[model samples]
Target chain A: MSQRHAVITGAASGIGAATAKALRRKGYWITALDLNDPGPLADLWHPIDLDARPYRLPEFDLPVDVLVNAAGLPPRPTTEAKVLRVNFLALRRVTEHLLPHMKKGGAIVNVASKAGAKWRENIAQVKRLIGQANDACLDDFVSAEKIDTVRSYDLSKEAVVVWTKKMTAGLVERGLRMNSVSPAAVETPILGDFTRALGERSTRGIELTKRSGTPDEIAGVIAFLASPSSEWVRGCNIEADGGLTAILDTENTIRPD
Target chain B: MSQRHAVITGAASGIGAATAKALRRKGYWITALDLNDPGPLADLWHPIDLDARPYRLPEFDLPVDVLVNAAGLPPRPTTEAKVLRVNFLALRRVTEHLLPHMKKGGAIVNVASKAGAKWRENIAQVKRLIGQANDACLDDFVSAEKIDTVRSYDLSKEAVVVWTKKMTAGLVERGLRMNSVSPAAVETPILGDFTRALGERSTRGIELTKRSGTPDEIAGVIAFLASPSSEWVRGCNIEADGGLTAILDTENTIRPD
Candidate 1:
């Protein structure tokens, strides 16, 4: 059989690189997009900065079997505009741009974060961001909403989770699937930035899970969501956080009446 | 390497039987427990009814690598007490009994249902049921809560989802993992019963998803949760419902402030 094709953003490092490797093991041709080159890991490489305007995606000759949006930025040291623009805006742009090239049974997996678990609590803001036009300036929105760097990162992911759910019915009708995976305190280059930004909150979550998760562990979940094995799984934000979300969720559960 | 051992309840038919097959393909030695013989599908078959009192489970000589609690009953034609006993009480009983026999890296996947997605809204009652002693009378609790057959099934699965989260921290400490899968409108033997009981709710979910999911689709998710690939994934209740839960969640989302 011919090899299937997969398009993955942020394929230069961390979870995106790991997902590229995992899909390669499954006999997929990797089409990688990143600011840095993905080296030989990608069968095809596209170098593009997601923060750049005009949001152009390359055309693919082969029908895409899977699309993984793994590119993102952490809160600390980064501007609120950059965080929201890269994490949410660019991620959605890549997905919408590539949807027409995806196969009928194709799947899309967005790398959201456990920080977005409280999306319901901030639904109004999440929806407002999602409702924004593709061309709208994120800086103005961030200023108007008084979004700090940390809140920008959190709300960006929240938008990813909510937007993933909102797009499910339409995507399923087109014989396609879309889902998201939220990992908590992963041991990546950005881990330091997260710890610096959230301090004890980040450390406490890692403490609860015993340790931070490896990129490969999170990649495994992304691979599963991108595979035919998870055909019936759609628009779900899977928390691959080593029980961190569960611990917090259980602790906050309402008491019996 | 020798084949790993797996213990699956409700292995006679439906998702249970399909999970047995999926795990078998992954080279796990299947120990099936059910009211009927699993025939060639099981490496060892223990004929037992989940509704029977005393809740006995056979002792495993081999260390179990996986335990899948797939045993469940639908609402129609079944009493409220029977549904709760078979779905929640017996499931928890079997898990506790077999946890001692499981390997250090063992995993447990419980078959929950999408009907239980409203667990947060009914957290109080769900916790009340989960807090009951192992030998507590489910019939008395059902009567006190005024739970009908449908609510009984829903609440039972809700207990499974919530209990799965509640157990994560302790299980992770022991080098074990536990998770659940919620499938919407699966084409199992009990599908007719669900359609009859839920009426429009069941059919509407199927309609939104385009078609009812096959048992194999749900089993595929259970198998992934049981595998080592999902090592960092603990206590997550995966919605393998083809976006049914997403549709409902999106529809109920709060408007922008």
Candidate 2:
């Protein structure tokens, strides 16, 4: 088989770095993108900060087979506007820019959060946010909507999930597939930020699941999504969160007879 | 790493056989069970008919690390009672019987159908069906409920999905994880039977997706679910149906502003 090329954002560390290793093990040529250099783990490196406006991606000569949007800012220690922009808008900007360069049979996997699972309940807000222009003033939007830093993080992820679904038909028509993975309380560098942002909610999820998920575990799901094994799977947000979503879903829906 | 053991039902053909191959590639000792012989695929084989009133599984000295309940019956050329029995009841029976032998940190993956996606809508009927005793008269129940062959097939799978969710807490408490995979149309031997039963519904799904899924595609999902890579995922029903569920979900929920 010929070698496949994968472009992964946030490839400097955590789930993105883990995915880089996993796909490298599968013999994929990795093009790592992040604010910091991903070192020797990347076959090629591109330093791009997601928070920068006019998000410009370098033109690629090679056809990309896989694109993983794993870059994001957590709630704590980040402004609400920055969280929304880095997490949602920048992801959209990168994907749109890379679409033409991606091969027909290529796949895209977005790293969403289990906190975005409540997208259904907040559909109106999510859709409104998704409707905003990429370069729109997110600060004004956040202030007007009264979205806090924590809520901004959740809303950004929720938008990611919804946008994935919205983009599915168009991508599938072009013979490309797209999906997302939602992990709960992963033991990444951003874990402390999430703990500070979510407080008891984050701790309770880890308590229920016994431990935080390893980045390798989330990457395993992403690797599967990028491969032909998941050829028939598209526009889905896979919950890799150790039964936390399951417990919440079942408890919320199931009633005693 | 020592070779782990996996017990898979319906191992004579389709997704079950494919799962056996996938797991074997990962150095798992496969114990295959089916009415027909699985031949060379099985390290050990047990012949058992799920349609039999008293479902009996052979004893094993090995501590099972994974269980894949891939046994099922389609809507066509099968009685309602047999369809329900083989698909849902037999699955529960085998899992309960084998729970003692299954190792802690082990996983169980149930094969369900996309037809069962409306499980939430039919939760009342699903819960009632699950409430039935193991030895209850399924034929009488079908007649009383006025369920036809197709409805039986859907109901059986719905029951499987709900049962997976219902069993999650208890199983997790025991250090065991359980989940289900729902595939759309797949090009298996039973594809004809499903086509005959579902008619235009099945063909429309195939048309929308451009083609049917391969058994290997579904098996890849089952393999991931059975591995430590999916340690955090439990009680979730993964839809591996080529964006069919996603289209339905997005179209159903998203409203015109």
Q: Give the alpha carbon lDDT tens digit for every residue of B1-257 in model 2.
A: 67899999999899999999999998999999899999988999999998986667799889999999999988965488888888998899999989999999999999999999889899888887888876468878888888987899999999999889878878889999999999999999999989999999899889877789899989988998998878878888889888887776677675443
The recovered share of true contacts, given per candidate in order, is 0.85, 0.63
Off by over 4 Å in 2: A255-257, B255-257
* Per-residue C-alpha lDDT of model 1 across residues A1-257, encoded as one tens digit per residue: 66889999999999999999999999999999999999988999999899888657788888999999999999965489888888998899889999999999999999999989889899989988887775357778888999987899899999999989989989998999999999999988889999999889999999999999999999999999998899999999999999998888888883322
When candidate 2 is compared with the true two-chain complex, its DockQ is 0.64
lDDT, residue A55, model 1 = 57
Query: Which candidate ranks first by DockQ, i.e. highest?
Result: 1
State the weakest 10-residue window (summed lDDT) of model 2 chain B. B248-257
**Candidate 2 — which pairs collide?**
A242-B232
lDDT accuracy of residue B139 in candidate 1: 70
Return the interface RMSD of model 1: 2.0
Clashes of 2: 1
RMSD of each candidate relative to the true structure: 1.6, 1.9
What digit string (tens of lDDT, one per residue) describes model 1 on residues B51-138? 8776567878999999999999999554988888788888898999999998999999999999888899999899888877753587
